[model samples]
Target: MIDDKTTPCPFLGEMVVMFCQAYPVRKPVPKHLITASNPCAGKGYKGCPFFKDIMAGLGGATGVDPTLASRDRKGVTS
Candidate 1:
């Protein structure tokens, strides 16, 4: 299996960008709707933009989720 942290990082970055571009409104995506499954298993935590912002808010790297900085601290999977 891929390290959980590394697996989701790229998807999270893309989500961050998508979320920022579509920000100012909250769009709730049902867990089933998301499709980044191979690496993330469609877990909102893996591909959900909200999580990216949350990770960023916790004094992490400005854009990408910091847990992705390595194969550690992947934290909770959606």
Candidate 2:
């Protein structure tokens, strides 16, 4: 779940919390967000909350990218 390594994700805290709740078995760390091998190893996940949470829980077991489950809204395009 490593982000791009450019900047820290604003949603990192929320994402980690959600991830822990969703997948109590595999508690991911902030390091995962920068490892490139984790499931949600990208950016823009900071926006899509649900998808991001799901991916964190899945932990690469699912090929689902949180960014793709995005829904369009006014001023919001992914």
Best-fitting candidate, scored by TM-score: 1
- Each candidate: RMSD: 16.3, 15.0
Clashes of each: 0, 5
List clashing residue pairs in candidate 1. Answer: none
Model 1 regions lying over 4 Å from their true place: 1-44, 61-78
C-alpha lDDT (0 to 100) for residue 13 of candidate 2: 55
Candidate 1 C-alpha lDDT tens digits along 25-62: 54444545445753334344546575565556556555
In model 2, the worst 10-residue window by lDDT is 15-24
Report lDDT per candidate.
0.45, 0.47
TM-score of each: 0.23, 0.20
Q: Let me know the TM-score candidate 1 reaches against the reference structure.
A: 0.23
TM-score of candidate 2 to 2 decimals: 0.20
Candidate maximizing lDDT: 2
